[model samples]
Target: MTHSPQLWQPLQYGTAEWQRVYFRLRNAIEGMNGFGKDPLYECLESGGTHRIRGIAAQAVLVAFQLAHANKRKLATWAGSIAVDGNRPHRRATRRRKTKPLGSWNHEGYLTEPSE
Candidate 1:
């Protein structure tokens, strides 16, 4: 692993609380998400909490925490959902229908873009 900035930095890794939370999340992800057999599980098993900031910070934190504890793949998926606001997959087109973006109305002004 390179020494560049990681996606998440450890706030405290060796603490008892961190270990407890990490193991709990790992078990939950493995048992609940069926990712126990994935290969990325070992890479994301480092026990630590991350400090995130922004509109979806909490959700991202939850995802990282899950990744740290359970399965990295599921955690990555969760992070993707949060980042994309749950956009539908492109390949699964038949199951989804496209809709026009909602019009925005602010300060008695209607902002409707031309189709």
Candidate 2:
């Protein structure tokens, strides 16, 4: 049996499969761009000039920003898993004791009963 090229041809633009793939690719690209602009990356806002002078410099800056973004993404992922109670490997930490502000005595004024 001969396989026709049309069998593997790309989906039509307005088709459901095409739209689903297009939206997934578009969202992935936009999400990465947003991550690069996030405070942790900051490369988009770093330099005094909006444009880099050399292609090498621009490439280096972008590479650095992508590395930092990846690092931050991994850190956040790890932290989430570490704190997730559903994860059996999650580590337990001591909770800090906190007191309400109303229980404190400021100067001569008592915020709450001293007892």
Candidate 3:
């Protein structure tokens, strides 16, 4: 039998640490793509005929979307600041519901609900 020396590399693709780093980076890129498509934020339209043509125009559009996303994020963070400036407001996972002013009764009269 013949023996051969193996070369050592710093970053092994199959390693746990490398996988974690790779996944994190991949997730970040995916998140950015989703953010760009968000209606409330960048609202980037990918379908149909594009208003701006050419590589330069597309690059400029992407740049503007990124800038808008950054601005909106900053504004949200700024608004979250507490009155005493001690801590930021916690993000609400669910939306708050508002009560309707009036409802129709048996007589078809619009009146407030009886408690």
Candidate 4:
């Protein structure tokens, strides 16, 4: 067994397919976390707004919050894909500056998904 398993994985980890798949999945997760923590959208931070007590109450609150967040995300996505006349036009994606890290991005991918 290797002393550090992370450094030993040298298979198909550096391929473009790997980067695209990993980044798409990772962006979804980070996007949700950022959306939930956003001040204008949600108040998920500690000592921010709510003062509810107990685990059950907190869980319920969070569940409802996430549900609302989902609805908002869906609405925003729909608006982005809104059609004009008879044609269905997709929203243009913004181009990002080149990052020093791999295609997965440095800030978003806190850790490797898997090798």
Window of ten residues with lowest summed lDDT in model 2:
82-91
Which candidate wins on TM-score? 3
Decreasing lDDT order of the candidates: 3, 4, 2, 1
The C-alpha stretches of model 4 lying farther than 4 A from their native spots are: 1-20, 84-115
Each candidate's clash count: 2, 0, 0, 0
- Model 2, 1-115: lDDT tens digits are 8758877657777899999999999998988788777754455655653367888988887787788888877776776663545753544788898776676676745475557
**What TM-score number comes out for model 2?**
0.53
TM-score of 3: 0.57
Estimate the TM-score of every prediction.
0.23, 0.53, 0.57, 0.53
Candidate 3 Cα errors over 4 Å, as ranges: 1-10, 48-50, 77-85, 89-115
Screening candidate 1 with a backbone cut-off below 3 angstroms (N, C-alpha, C), the clashing residue pairs are 26-69, 26-70
Over 4 Å off, model 1: 1-10, 33-115
Clashing pairs in 2: none
User: Candidate 3 lDDT, tens digit per residue, 43-77?
Assistant: 77664324788999888878887888878777787
Can you list the residue pairs that collide in candidate 3? none
Worst 10 residues of 3 by lDDT: 1-10
The candidate with the higher lDDT, 1 or 3, is: 3
Q: Candidate 1 vs candidate 4: which has greater lDDT?
A: 4
lDDT of each: 0.56, 0.73, 0.75, 0.74
Model 2 scores what on Cα lDDT? 0.73
